[model samples]
Target: MRTRGSLFRILGLCLLAGALVAGTLLPVVALAGVVTNEASETVESLSAELADEPPPLVTTITDRNGDPVATLYDQYRIPTAAEEISDAMKWALISVEDRRFYEHHGVDWKGTVRAALNNTSGGDTQGASTLTQQYVKNYLINVIYRNDKAGQQRAQETSITRKLAEARIAIQLETTMSKDEILVGYLNVVEFSRQVYGVGAAARSYFGTTPDKLTVAQGALLAGMANNPSIYDPWSHPERALERRDFVIDKMVENRKLSEEDAERVKDEPLGVLPDGPDKPAANCVGAGPENGFFCQYVEDYLLEHGMKKDDLYTGGYTIRTTMDPVANHAAKESAEQQVDKTEENVANTLSLVKPGKDRHEVVALAANRDYGPDAAAGQTEFALPSAISNVTGTGSSYKVFTAAAAMERGVAGIHDTVQSPSRHVSDVFVGGGEQCPTVARGTRAYCVTNASEGGSGSMTLQTALQTSPNTAFVILEEQAGMRAVLDMANRLGMRKTMASNAATGGAPDPDAESAEARQSQLEFFGPSENSPGKGSFTLGVSPTSGLELANVAATILSGGVWCPPTPIGEITDRDGKPRPLQEEQCEQAVPEGLANTLAVGMSKDDLPGGTAHAAAQGVGWNRPMIGKTGTTQHNGSAAFVGGTPQLAGAAMVFRPDRPYGGLVDGGPGNVRATDGDSGNMFGGKTPARTWFGAVSKILEGQEVLPLPAADPRYERVN
Candidate 1:
């Protein structure tokens, strides 16, 4: 109102003041808050990661007999990561994922800025995750910051919220951990799926190597996968995985982690992986002994029952200096495999034989043939061995040897003791009202006859009866020894208990619904028992004994009463390679050396002229001496050859093919044939003896075979 100039100046001043106010207030209200590089410091904290408990693993070991084997374990888990992580792998990881991993605190600022700008310009959401964020997400917790109200709600509501809580926690982690420790924790906590957790496990699963052995390229590939595991799975997405790997190579070069030339070459390298699924210890091969799988399993079970831990097998790095000779085990398994192969075409059944020894036992052979299934036919199940833990039952004839040995030990019988065969029977009957039958009778008087019962082996003495394996003769002698003497003798030989636990339990009826059980229930081979000592069948080898038990008994004879517990394992060491001390071991000497020598001498005499083991005797190379025994069961079920040299002793057995068919698995007439033709005349002397000879010949280093220290005080044989 005062004038035109004054009015204009006032208006200008007002506009200027308003502009100043807008500028000052706009900056204050539009402030995006502090952005001083929200990078993590070394003082970061973190939540405790969940520790993984792995699966339970089992291990096993065995004797040549394929008996209850031994076992080993480490936390019952095969820790893939613990075995795989190494320094080489660490370097490779850095080379691929974060070359400046050690130099940077928790973020690569330049990388983050460029990524954020690109996302903003493109109107899309992307990430600039550094190694620290990746580790935090995978191991510590997830990190999520967003702009929407719902997003804010989510940040405060879910595990992601908990994860944010963890960021606060992780920021404190740096205070408690070193850089290397954090990295290790990251590697250990990361998951590669398939129940495999940790870089160590991934190394083994993917590359068949430990972290230390990881190739530069391999490390890069593995590290790169942590960004997106499913999309980069090499096994499932080879092409995509390779492309991702090449991208890593390019990034590595961009960051100067690798020279350009090296990077280019690595990018072009074709991806390859091991054909086998993964690399690990073969549990099927325990103690890494010569025996096959079945025998190993047997030994494993026995050891476990005897106080050996299951974990000691794998991680224990046990130096199982076994009593078994590898060469012998191989031979026995091979021979048995061949025989069983030819005999069984429907199911797999193998035989494993062991020869007892003074220094180390010998494996005669492990035999399995395809009579079970396609797997068996393919040789996959031979060592996989069927769990025959319950299939124990045989005749009682084997008990006679024990009876004879016991009588000798008890001073109740001697080599000179003679009992007329075919005479009136006088054996003790365990059941009600015993019968009085005559000895195997000749025309008018009883005379000893061989087990064959074809003709009289002549009026042979008691020792001669043992040498000739005369069934009639032993029966008559047992009668004379009296029931108490025979029973007492059998008990001492360790045949007091039934082989099958079911038989030992109550004389219960068969609960097995399987047809095989129904059929087996009717046979003596099933080993049905009403009492400890049955009334009549004790004369014949009618008691079930494992190949191991048989070998032990024969070993007792060979060792002259010294029952050396068969040694299958010798040494165990810790992860640090320190040897583990074992508890003191003690063994019981079950018989006198004199009595044992008598059994050995009597058995060895079979290697002489006109003995039941004449075939075995012929194989001994007339230049040296040998001792052996042959037993053929009724119905052609089992044929056995138990024998040894001065330094070694062993036994072999072959199940005849004449077994009646039970089911599709019974391996009927058309099932398959044993390597040896299933001729009616087949005997243990043929296959078992030959296999035993093959194994022993290798261990003996061509040494002369000798008998036990002579039992004949009157007649001495040179040692």
Candidate 2:
């Protein structure tokens, strides 16, 4: 209903003044297809015939494929002069709004006199301004020329002097325009609510229909809501709205606008409203756990990082074309949710999947706590950690996937490179002690061991260490690769973005600074380095990272080391129906396909029984194999499963946020349990695996999954 921005800008003279002024013209003279009439003349003539104009209103919602999901509006419009306006609406508006609508051309002298009398009486505030005057105030005045909050406030405030000025403007408008023209302007320019401006919005918001199609009772209701809408809004206050509507119907019957039967029928009709508006997520994932909430939060954060406004997420009326398929997303969520129940440990899980050369991705599943709330899941207080979707854990053993890729990409080491896994010492180790930590490999001088911790696998290749996820194996590799090399590789693979602690503001940070000795102690590494002292435990997957973080860690390998900015929105169109093109982000290749293949081949070891991901391999066919890893922190409290099909990459996480520090000191290790309830065996293979499988299967039901491009050129059997 509001005029286009360009048109408003072009005619800014009358609007420049503090008062709102609008001019209307009728067809008084016709020459060469140009109809001309004096604005004053149309306003001054009450008997002149007017052309019909039915305002257009559209409601549309589309799917990811740009197909119409739903539509609620007029399919076609056939205008006619005899198309009578609702008499009840006219009289209700005229009675309390403009009693002199049919009299005085546009300006009502008698009404103005009465308004002045009422003002002087000083009993209650009253306005004698006509509808034409009100339309001018809503559009021209509010749309332009106002500056500063005070100016805006003043314009909004209706007063006696303003009413008088409005009368003069209304008279001018009526003199130059036909009655129908004035009516059209009035219908178009009126403000129904904050965003519900004009009759079109009012129709949808209230009766859920277009203006022309409104029934007599519905028309009366809309007319009643014209002034002080909030008090009579049917959705918010149905009783009051119905009372006001009945008042309009009564007035129409009194004015002979409608017969007694029509009035009775319409007044008794039940009010119904159409549902079409933005639905905000309750907390994060719609009464779901933290894993989903966190992922949604991650998407929000990504948008913010890309310079999008927070308001846009809720009210921008934008359709986001995400790389996520709803089916896959639902499947993943179901799988993860179902899996979380199997684990007695207090934990959460999240998974994401992406396909090759496609914009559609899937967030398979996420479950934050063992149960939802206190006395809700299992009467456990440990479930109280904030379940917001952004609380991603630190990448534990999954970090090696990156480290190995970094070595391969930089040529620091090859998949065939020899490393002693059983050796006692290596580099950049963060935990464990001297003699007890056996040196499986010989490289730098910090004691390290396999993840199993029994003894080293003797001597093994770098690929073997990766497949086995040995603690000492990765330490020796990291030592040889150097911290700078490892960090460089991490940076290339989007690891910097995964560091939740490094956020600018509103992020969690260490409360107290560490002592000088503690800082020095933290800097020690297992690899031989001039900058870092040797301490080896880097390969055990002892680090921390969120499901998304680890998912992307695997995603880098899945994507052939080419990083693409994940997005939910595809294209944005303006009100004028013009598409705004978004720049396609260029891909950044972080590692060679050959190296990625080596890791993929090793990761495929999960299909074998001795492999960490043996559970995931149990029921799947050989047509499209699942390649991924299963990680468990020292305590059984946290577990993760990261894997993907040829088309998608996703990660699922499960952890106990409330477990006391290590929890081992307590007889039961507090929230960090190794098994669920009485099962005595709880691992990622159970719940996390089920969630991962369910989601993956549902998502890939009918879709084709391309084979992952080989990462190692030297490995002939990789394909």
lDDT at position 258, candidate 1: 71
lDDT of 1: 0.48
User: Per-residue lDDT tens digits of candidate 1, residues 149-207?
Assistant: 54334333323223223233333334444566557656754655344446665767677
Question: Model 2, range 56-160, lDDT digits (tens) per residue?
Answer: 233233334554322222211111121334444455566556655676576666665576567657756666567766665655333331223654454444444
Model 2, residue 625: displacement in angstroms? 4.0
Q: Supply the global lDDT for candidate 2.
A: 0.50
The lDDT values for all models are 0.48, 0.50
Best by the lDDT measure: 2
